[model samples]
Target: MLSSYLTLAAILFCIGLYGTLAKRNAIIVLLSLELMLNAVNLNLIAFSKYGAIPSLTGQLFSIFTITVAAAEAAIAVAILIALFRARGTVLVDAFNRMRR
Candidate 1:
C-alpha cells in the first residue's frame, strides 16, 4: 500500500514536471507547480503513516508546504496579472524580452 502511494505520487510528479517544462502559458506552469507540491504532500503523508516511528512530523511539514504553496500561487498570479496587463500576453516566451 505504501509502495502504491509512492508510485502514484511519482506519476503525479512526472506529469507535473512535464507540464511545467512543456507548457507555454504561465497559468499552466503555475498549476503544474501546484501539482508538484501536492505530490510532495502525498509522499509525506504516506511516509508518516508507514514509518516505524510514526509521528505528526510529516503531516506538519505537509501543512507548512501547503501554506507556502498557497502564498506562492497568490504572488505568482498577481505577477502574471500585472504582466498580462503590461504586455497583453501570458505566454512564457513573451516574457523573455523584459523590456517594453
Candidate 2:
C-alpha cells in the first residue's frame, strides 16, 4: 500500500515536472507547480502513516507545506495578473524581458 502511494506520487511528480518544463503558459506552469507540491504532500502523508516510528510530524510538515503553497499561489497569481495587464500575454517566454 505504501509502495503504491509512492508510485502514484512519483508519477504525479514526473508529469508535473514535464508540464513545468515544457508548458509555455504561466497559468499552466503555476498548476504544474501545485501538482508537484501535492506529490510531496502525498509522500509526507504516506511516510507518516507507514514509518516504523509513525507519528504526526510528517502530517504537520505537509500541512505547513500546503499553507506555504497556498500563499505562493496567491502571490504568483497576483503577479501574473499584473504582468498580463502590462504585457497583454501570459506566456512564460514573454516574461523573460521584464523591462521596457
State model 1's lDDT.
0.96
Model 2 spans > 4 angstroms off? 98-100
State in Å the error of residue 98, model 1. Answer: 4.7
Q: What is the lDDT of residue 74 in candidate 2?
A: 100
Q: How close is candidate 1 to the true structure, as a TM-score?
A: 0.94
Please list the C-alpha lDDT of all candidates, in the order they appear: 0.96, 0.97
Q: What is the C-alpha RMSD of each candidate to the true structure, in Å?
A: 1.7, 1.7
Candidate 1, backbone clash total: 0
Per-residue lDDT of 36 in model 1? 98
- Which consecutive 10 residues in model 2 have the weakest lDDT in total? 91-100
Pick out the ten consecutive residues of candidate 1 with the lowest summed lDDT: 91-100
* Model 2 per-residue lDDT tens digits across residues 1-100: 8999999999999999999999999999999999999999999999999977789999999999999999999999999999999999999899878475
TM-score of 2: 0.94
